[model samples]
Target: MALHPALTPVADLVGTWRGPGRGEYPTITSFTYTEEVTFTDVGKPFLTYLQRTWSPAGDPMHTETGFFRVAGGEAVEFVLAQPTGQTELAEGSLVTEPRGFATELHSRVVNAASAKIVDATIRRLRLDGDELTTEFAMAAVGLPMTHHLGSVLTRTA
Candidate 1:
């Protein structure tokens, strides 16, 4: 089957990416992790997204499920939910670069009553050839937005 028209703009992400990542926050100790991210083309206007991270010892750390959609024109939307009780709607524009496309998305967060206090988040993704780099920052726990995680993953599929 052919790729969906709207998904063409982000088609480079349609595969699995895996690599090492580092994370840190003011409220917690810095750590190292193995990150895996997948973007699957489902013959629809959106791509199914899944991400997982594991500790150096192979213990599971975190996971996220989301969908990536073209809102209209060059604008894109990402809807994400994590087991930690936060659902995020992030909107931004996709721009072409020398090697691939990049997008910086700012999200509106919704938290469950018992979830940690997360006010906002920003996710930045850059794809260069077969390498995918990601940066994430968030505002939570009464602290301001700060850098949290960064990863560099290679296309494995």
Candidate 2:
């Protein structure tokens, strides 16, 4: 099938990207990982998005499969599901500048294992000719935490 019209603008992200990433909460840790994101269109209004994250230490931390849709001009919604017992229904609007595209996503993570919910806000920035960066601010387990998950990812494929 062909790509969705709304997702065509994000076609650049449909590949493998690698870089060092940091996760911060009460503590900070660094790791190297390769992120594989694929976008598929099924003749729908939205794009089917799948992301696999892997580290040198193991296979993959998580995989996200979802649909990307647009509304209110530049606003976007990402509904994702994971096999590790989690799902996120996030919504955000795009902030496009001369440099890149910035999306501020507000979501809630439902932990299917513990029946816990976490409120999260993520800012994902993608520069025109640079790597992608995502900063996450979350209130998980009744604790406020802010960190960088994918500090930067260089295109590897």
Find the candidate with the highest TM-score and give its number: 1
lDDT of 1 by residue, 56-80 (tens): 9999999999999986649889999
Per-model TM against the reference: 0.98, 0.76
Off by over 4 Å in 1: none
Residue 48, candidate 2: alpha-carbon lDDT: 81
For candidate 2, give the lDDT: 0.66
Query: lDDT at 110 for candidate 1?
Result: 99
Reference-based lDDT, residue 85, model 2: 66
Question: Which 10 successive residues of model 1 have the least lDDT summed?
Answer: 68-77
